[model samples]
Target: MARSATTIRRSTLTVPVAPLGPENPLPPLLPRDDPHRIDPRQRATLPPDMARQVGYAPLTSVLPTRLRDGYGRDRVPTDLDTIVLENDRLSVTVLPAYGGRVYAMRHKPTGRDLLYTNPVIQPADFALNGAWFSGGIEWNIGATGHTTLSCAPLHAAVLDGPGGAPMLRLWEWERLRDLPFQVDLWLPEGSDFLYAGVRLRNPHDGTVPVYWWSNIAVPETRHGRVLVPADEGWHFGYEHSLTRIPFPEWRGADRSYPLHGDFPADYFYEVPAGSRKWIAAVDRDGDGLVQTSTATLRGRKLFVWGAGPGGRRWQRWLTEDGAPGYAEIQAGLARTQLEHVPLAAGGEVSWVECYGPMDADPTVVHGPDWAAARAHAEKRLAATLPEATVDAAYLAWLPLADRDPDDVLHTGSGWGALEVARGGYALPGTPYDPATLGPDQRPWLTLLDTGRFPEEEAAPERPPGPSLVGGPWRERLECAPGGPLTDYHLGVAQWHAGDRAQARRSWERSLSAAPSPWTARCLALAEAWGGHPQRAIAVSLAAAKRALATQGVDPVALAALARDMIPVLLDAGRADIARRVFDRLPQDVRARGRFRLLDARILLALGDREGARAVFDAGFEVADLREGDEILSTTWALLTDDPLPAAYEFRMRPA
Candidate 1:
């Protein structure tokens, strides 16, 4: 592992991209917004500080970050902007426009891909903003789960790196916490490792809760084994519980292998203090990817989708036919992703990460004795890329962290530009150029400068636009001239800040000003999350009716609303009204897979089992199916004793 010559070049990666169709016009909301959110069962087992961080800055709302759930299943060949960093032994391709992900890392000597290069780009209902695809080395920042920037772009530039090689730096203003973060990646000459230096900075005047996870997806196989330093881990699943579990083997089976179990779960390795942090996924042949980071990223994890039908279905859904399954080996700032550590005012945390190939003895790694297996892998890691080298690389990259961009490689969201204009920040390395601001930020820019939200000429399809939930924006809205649009946006900002009572009042006043669907839906969400299900049902129904009555309304917007509201009615046993809502939908709108699925629920509620079964027999595909969604299987089971078809068999549990 000696330094040699390196190369950096800009290129395009053309793949079949299931185009992210559009931003859902509706502001996304949840049934409940839990502040200080963590599993109650975990309190006794966790350290107080880690428990506190888990509840810290629980993302109450995703206002400014609009939902990107509008992607479809159809894919077309698309060219994504990419930056290729090559050395004598390694080649790394980073997608500048797509969440600054390392799309592929090839070990030139073996001609191997060290990370899961998802054969296709298929967005699904994952990320905090709803559209997340599975693959690559994804830099997850903001709150827990996938970052809002998963499918979004990042500002990219080139700067001097180690050995005077060109470094690719991606930075942007993360809107949720109103923070700035940057990722600097480079290949040091002939070294096989790809080094990435990540920095998350809190620019605010007060403490802000921050989360960062470097998620690296590797190909999963029956013979694959994940090696981590820890002998114990915190296991979490869709069951909403976290429990202490021994490493490698859980219960009887060795959960280290992806196929050992049949349900998706997370095993967050409890790496002992002073241990060198690293995780690897090695196959039977002992050829695999290894990710190790400097001390700041103390947590390592193994996320498996498992061998269940749901997991398999999702695996195929995200990639092309015949592509292998993938599992994520992640490194983070906390023991588990459920926590968000607090970053002090004007404070910053930076660390370097190394990703490349590792060679191990397959027998010991896949052995029955967990301790020996783990120790053998650790020894190999220590020899391959010593802990000292990772630390040294981090230290060397620190001084060059703030070097201004010498060449702008790609443009990202204008939200950063707007933030720059508001704070007059002198962010050197990641310049938020004013010229990047576009129509999306124009209204907010107007609100910031003039304390007035620019309104469009009245139109049915023009619901209240996207929201700005920053404290400063909320204060500006509270002072702005009150109108339906202004008050509605103000309520959204308040809700995001965990001020439910104030948000409710603002929306009420907005609804009184103009009984619009947008304002009504916000108020209903407040009611639901406040434990007033009956009131919520009524308010949501009213909102749906209001939208239905409005002319020139975008059909897509109306469909999104019904898709959200009908479930509430059905959950409350008000299927009669839910049926009314469905009957009112335009034929084409009701024909979408999501609605047709809802239609089956209505039929089942009406005691028409045959009708429900017939709907399934007709065949359809839900493009935005969630990660653990088993509703199709549940509905199918309810319909009859017949086996659920392959297309509809996404049941992760043993039903």
Candidate 2:
């Protein structure tokens, strides 16, 4: 009997799991008299109506839960409990435990994994909110960066599509934003490609930005090359300057080629005009993987850590020694992950993406020569079998006598699966009972209050306090002395309390520990507010330079710091220094509405009234000038020696 091109089977394999490691202890839960607390005046600045609408809360009221170590010594599972979907061309393994990640995908013909797989399941403090792991195809939805649900398990079920074709369905709730989404993954019979359909739903009345990115990691080697159909790309760095550069060539080297030097590079590329809808990575041997999605998915990104010492250090931190360092080929729903589109209340958006293997000629070294690879991809895409139409009505079917309560299985209409142990799954139209389900099938409600859940409720409720002068925030900081997050929060409290010196110290200490552009920006702001303009300029400039030179720093944070520095430097009567910093900024940053006014001011101060007017005129066409339009208009009028635009606005303080 001949084997089918694609088949779905449930099986288990013993996989290594690391024990929970040491806990990072939290501070006390009581408020105390301290300078590092939010001031009454600052608290009053928050509009009551706005706060009520957004469910705003204070930092002091939120108590930290006991930390659990997710990374410890490794141990393998005794049971084999995994689902495998494969075709003659490729194989995919799905793990329900690791947030339903596509644990491994292999190109069967070459016996190599199309996606990188960690040797052991080791969770670490890598997530922006904490608890993340490397490798595999991670589905990020809702907020930007890694989704809070990245480390949690998801509701999963196996279902049959039209004509009884096998499919796996995984769904989870975006608790923070009150959004729900589902991903259906299928490998059609006799097909070489695996397809994913993502459906996102917003049920609330308030509009919110929707962010989704599929992060795929692959083995990084000198011979590996990432190929995107785009001819040119937009690159944003730590300084948050969005520079347009020719594709493949960034800085000096061809970035499409795998990491060869000693630094990390992160580049987000927009879809080029008339480009095909796919991105791929091919090795020196010409064996590679390709991912294609609908035109709705607009962004392609490449993240690589070169073979330098810094890159190697990060490699060791992310994985065990000897484990291969990998690069990521990510796809985003917008032009960049930082840019999100609005999802209107009660709205829905969905799209489909396909993944498979491609064989290319080893001799194709450059972008121009990638025609062979593209042709190979086109053939595979053209050969993709049509998916059977899935029936939606069968999703509510009752369990069969022999079926495990936790096992998600296909019904004729839809899928039948157990609810997650932690309660967040509110199936839009489908309802289920928690009391009738077993422990594994029941919702885990306790996790919600413990801050382990990703919902907004995990944040602390507002506590009644005029200021942190007699608040619990001080005790919390005392308890968690070395935590960078704690220190940053403490600095915020100090800044609001009019203790600028202490705030500067706290921010500096936080930066020393975590080295984030965010903390550095805060420190610069503290210095400027504390009447030290020179120190503020120095701090902001140093931070910006460091961010530009270093890898792994968030470009958004860097951009904010650089943008804020212009106003601070100009206020300090140092337009020359401001111009220097502004010149280093990416063209996109300079083109911002706020920066246009600053640019005109700098030119005006340099005795170039005509240049300033030209910039202001250009700003009207290109910038989204909002709050400071009147200020810019007045500056322009004064530059032209026209009649004063308005009475001089001034404030006076008693002597």
Candidate 3:
């Protein structure tokens, strides 16, 4: 089969494992307290004041069996195990045993702020059956309150449809000790018009409540506006209580001092129990808005915090030394790995909150086509998904970020520092002053634009291909003025350099500036790079379809490209989505025999031995036909089921 002529047909390819949840060691839940650093030098960095303000305790502390009993610390309790909750609004499982806790917890104590905590087991010195375990403490109730407990170690918190079916987000981990198992839970299952969740499982499992507060740093611009519901709330306290601000809400408390900057903050609103209201911090000038909640918890309560842009608390912990923009749904946990709760022995905790979109001007929705916003999000989400084995490929890619020769591109340590390449793709890249791209770079830029360059010049004096961009790559993306190629290159470069924020921005801009099948591929890779495989799969399929209609491209080539991404996508928690996309492809595309070897590798994901054999058979028959490097290598490995062949090749081109 001619590789270029082969069409891609959707086919079912089951991912053996779910996407890997956030598993690496994130920054400590505590605030950054580098006394040696100074403002701008240390400005916007996580402050010591923020660290001291919030309480974070690891579960590693010897929890006398008594407290353990309260939190189901002993054997996984049967009550919390193997139970599934289903209803019209939502479907979920709560498994207390086998390291599976609540998938979605929604029942809030009469007067408690919605708080979700993971009950994890600190394994004994000697491994039990050579196993280490952890689980989630979550609850999901529909609008009517039907619930279930899933004990399958792989299933954790998931967002069913906004108003439809349940989407499973399983929380799982390998048997690695000394790493905190964490899980995130959104207080409200499906609230208002938006969905958000916070992963709060930290490795430490310290005794502290680990109260994390979110300060939505929304930006106001000339053409943008912030949107949030207009509702009443009580000022609980400043996110970082140490930040000096107006103390109108503080009765007799001494307010922290030396307030600076132009934007003055007012209150820390505390939403009371039974209050179903949501708030939004909007930038009328820029059209940016953050709809969030602020609540204070005493004993096992969830504390949700927020601050306006440029406010003390917002700038303190959120602002990084190199990157100043800060707007995220944050929590006070190191990872999403939760401790394994022993059956019904652990204390049961529930969180309740709602999310809604507020109209900044109420007429903005009517001002322009309101559908545009929804369409934008849907399109973006669609562009972020992949097909077939792409998810698995994504799952495999997550760990590689840690092992990446340029770890600064994808690790938390490299959150913001990175650069984009000329293709509008985010990849491991180096920061070069545009002014530096002189005659020497013309050859490279020409190749980047036309996808062709002299073979002789291809081998540059730099560190081989794509590695000589920078030394000690940045931890974030550093933006500069440039065109589509510049932005694209910058995005990929930042990703390669390990700056997620920069990568996200550059790729988003790349797609907007030039929405094409290639841009879709770039978006999918970026999502996979960020550890979101499901989204990656979705976008890949859309891109394939778009390419089919617009570019008259071969589907098998698309599948082959998609298949290249399966490992990383799987790592990002989109196994189901990836499988769905693969299954949806046309059958002719599957039998094209072009990506046949690659498809055979996908069989390993689906547990199809016959499929594996078929690929090998074809490989043997076509031994004389020169095959692409990826196809030849993948086929050889799948046929023999050996690890060695799979390891070799693919060093020259990125998946």
Per-prediction TM-score to the true structure, in the order listed: 0.94, 0.56, 0.24
Q: Best candidate per lDDT, number?
A: 1
lDDT of 3 by residue, 1-655 (tens): 2212111111121211212122111101111111111233222443453333222222221101000100111233222334343332223333433333332322221221111222323221111111222222332210000011122133233332222233223233111111112232221232211223222222222321332222222332223322212122122222212222332223342211112112332233223344322333223321222233223211111112223232322232222233323222221121111111111211222222222223234344213443343233223222332122222322332332211121111111111111123423222212222433444345445454554432343211111122112211221113334445445555554554456587668767766765655556657766765667567767766665565455445443444445434544445554544455555556764544443544555665666768766656554211111111234554455557554332133211223
Which 10 consecutive residues of model 2 have the lowest summed lDDT?
A: 646-655
- lDDT, candidate 1, at 173: 91
- The parts of candidate 1 lying over 4 Å away from their true place are 1-4, 31-38, 456-458, 528-542, 641-643
What candidate 3 gets wrong by more than 4 Å, as runs, is 1-164, 170-192, 196-208, 214-244, 247-277, 285-345, 352-356, 362-655
| Winner on lDDT (1 vs 3) | 1
Compose the digit string of candidate 1's lDDT tens values, residues 1-655. 6555787889998899998987888777562232113566666567888777776767666767788877888899999889999988998998877898889999999999898889889898888778888888999998888889998899998989866877999999998788889999998877889999999887678999899999999988878889988888988877667788987777898888978888788899889988888988999988898889998999999888888877788788888899998999999999999999989988899999998888999888888888898788878888889999999998899889989888888888898888888877766677888899888788889888888887552244556667888888888898999877888888888887788899899889888877888778778767877888899889989988988988888877888788878887787778899999899999988888988899999999989999998999999888877666778888998999988899997765556
Backbone clashes counted, model 2: 13
